[model samples]
Target: MQRLVLRRKEFSLFQAFIYKNIGISLGDHKIYLVQARLAKRVKQLGLESFGEYYDFLVADRKGGELEYLSSLISTNVTSFFREHKQWEFLKSHLASILERSGGRLRIWSAACSSGEEPYSIAMFLAEHLPNMTQYDIKILATDVSPKVLKIAMSGMYSQKACMSLSDEYLRKYFSPVLVENEAYYQISDMLKKQIIFREFNLVTGDYDLFAQKAFDIIFCRNVMIYFDRPTQNKLVDRFHAILAKEGHLFIGSSEALTDMKKEFKSKSASIYQKA
Candidate 1:
């Protein structure tokens, strides 16, 4: 059988398919990238062309192929304190925010990839909030990738992932371990207990899990670039609705609310406050 290759026409078809199906907009310039990401699947299925692969994906209902598609397209590279300044701001204001909230704190790490961001939030809370044990402090960590969510649930990381972490943090929050001939560190039970991980898609517009509960803080950083302007506005509106009055929304450093509604006011760099 001849090897299958993704051509321009098939790539355009896929761009339309993904945009209509999942709201992911891929430009014509991404043809090479599409080919690279899906070539392996094509070969594995013994497909003759990218069109067949596209059809297979469209007809796939078991979610295996959909999951693969998400993995290929979603950007998940993150680290502990990737945006250090944001963490610094959180640390500075968390105490006052918690106090004003009547000792209850609800934070959401939206699109939390591989858990570092949520765990970092948990650690900061654990360290600064002395009366944290008395309050109802919860961190809702969500992501679209089931594969990444599984890793996040495990709360384990390699030394490389922990390199930026200070020695004190490592000693205070994590315990070193060797699992399956690999060196890694696992988050302490104290920090792990404060977080709840689940799979969620921001594009779905269903937030029933947080229907009754409004968050005091939501860190939806860096995930919106994948979405189009209209989708971005819709998701931001949802965030505004779900956030409590004066709640903080932290986006990626590079992402801005160019077309965002007037309900949110810019509070700081890449930070917005509900109006």
Candidate 2:
């Protein structure tokens, strides 16, 4: 199989398409990244070049190929409790959050790749909240890709995927199983029932779909780094609009709200409170 070089012109077309349709800003340095990631797909689809693949994607009226492209270009690298300090912050503030919301909790895990974050939220609340069954708790986990959402809905993880979790959490929240002679763990139904997974595009999806001041916490971590500053500010503004008063927003440690307008007060590094 001949490796298709993603020519500069072809790269520009994809770069524009991604920015226009998906809201991700690809810098010139990312040309190699795009070429490397899309090469396998180009080969698998029997397409000769990235340009042809791009055309096929545009011709995909149902937006399926575009979704696949989004999945490929976008980073979905996530794990359960990826940001340790944020969790510690949440632990310290859980009592006040619960009191303010009167025991009803609503959370949105935006760009929730492969379910670990939302599952972690569910498990965290169950472990910390007293008499968890007596409260109304719902977690909405969303991502742009259906492929990863399907994996999330299955609530199954390989032994390797469960590495970051504690032995107690693994024993309590997951059931060990074998799939084709490989060790796997299934998330308990109690946790699964608390979450609803859906497809969403942070850049292009309708924000009107969400109620104003609906969420107590919004986890849009690690994803904003892919967008340009304007997109990042707009995303932060939307998060601020939807979060309940004093609600917290947790972003990736590598990200910051420093240059953006001060709609949210910095509670900690990468953690902000709606003011």
Candidate 3:
């Protein structure tokens, strides 16, 4: 990849541009990183400079170019059963949570990438909450990137994604399909029915968390690392507002709210309860 050395002013301009357009705040030090990630697109478009590419992103009216730009900027690294401790907590507390909320359950897998986390939740609920059949159990999965959301809605994955799941759960919850020497597991329709996928941008608008209803559990793990301190604070406050009384918020294992206002108190190492 060709290294495009961006000047400090140019970097700031690009950052402002993207923040205005897509709500991603790239710092000055990320110039090289941005170039590295986007160099291929620049070359493929036969652009002479990063500025030209930026202009195209802003001015492109076809919508495809803008979608491609958003796809490049968004981060989508995720795995099945990440942070197993949280899942353990969910399993332990499922009965109590359901009981406390009058047997109605709504979970928001915010920033769900390629459907792993939500599907894991569905599988867990399927295994543990047999009473879920009588109750309203729904998982709302949302992401900013439509591409990733489409993949997530498909609920198809390779064996690597299901490695953490047990054989019994795998056989019961998913069906295998052979495609070109590799097997892809498709989530059973029963489990898929419990999840609702949508496109959402956490930074730009007001989500429907504070409407008539609220989520019982909000699993927004590993998503806030992209925002600055102010953005993080705003997002956390929004989370606190939308979360039902006594609702739980699960964040990334390494992420904490030390820098932000303490609306949620730590219940466990990485879990916080809305206060």
Candidate 4:
């Protein structure tokens, strides 16, 4: 098979399309990177050129191809308890958060790549809170890609994925399973029931669906670095709008709201409270 090259023109079209739909800013130098990432899919589909794939995506009225494209371009490098500092902050303020909520809490794990974030949230709460079933807590885990959501719904993980978790968490939250004689850890149904997974495109999804709802905590970490400034500001504003009073927003420590004016007051590194 002849190597398919993503021409400059095709790269420009994809760059604009991705930014418009997903709010990701791919630089001009990323032409090769995009090509390398997407070339296999293009080849598997028997497409002759990247331009043809673009046309296919445009003609895909159901938006499935675009979701697949989003998956390829976006990295899904996540693990159990990836951000240690954020959890520490949450632990410090957990009592106040519970007091404010009065035993009811809603958390949104935005861009929940492969379900580890929400699952970790469930496990953490079960570990920290006094009663196992007293509080009302639910996690809404959403992502733009359906492919990842399917994996999340399965609640299965490789042994490598379980490395970050503690032995106690492993014993309480997960069950060891043998899949074709290979070891795998599957999250217990008790924890799985605590989460609701859905397909949500943060850049293009409608916020009106949340007009009547507000979350106590939102975890939109490590995702904004892919977006440009204007896009980031717009997305941040949406998050601010849907957060309950004094609700918390957790972002990646590396990603900061430097020049943006907003209602959130910084409490700690990458942790914000709605004012």
In angstroms, how far off is 46's CA in candidate 4?
Answer: 1.2
Evaluation by TM-score, superior candidate among 1 and 3: 1
How high is the lDDT of residue 219 in model 1?
95
Give the better candidate number (3 or 4) by TM-score. 4
List where candidate 2 sits over 4 angstroms from the true fold. Answer: none
How do the residues 46-128 of candidate 1 rate in per-residue lDDT, one tens digit apiece?
88788988899989989788777777777798999888888888888877887778888899999898999999998888788
Q: What is the TM-score of candidate 1?
A: 0.94
Per-residue error at 160 for model 2, in Å?
1.2
The parts of candidate 4 lying over 4 Å away from their true place are: none
lDDT score at residue 249, model 1, on the 0-100 scale:
95
- RMSD, one per candidate, in order: 1.7, 1.2, 2.3, 1.0
lDDT of each: 0.86, 0.91, 0.82, 0.91
Candidate 1: C-alpha RMSD to true structure equals 1.7
Clashing pairs in 3: none
Model 4 error, position 272 (Å): 0.6
**How many backbone clashes are present in model 3?**
0
Residue-level lDDT tens digits of model 3 in 83-158: 9899898888878888888988889998897999899889888888776699888899988788898889998889
lDDT of 4 by residue, 113-211 (tens): 999999999988988885959888889999998889998999999899999988888888899999999899999999899999999999999999888
**TM-score of each predicted structure versus truth:** 0.94, 0.97, 0.91, 0.97
By TM-score, is 2 or 3 better?
2
* Candidate 1 CA-lDDT value: 0.86
Higher-ranked by lDDT: 1 or 3:
1
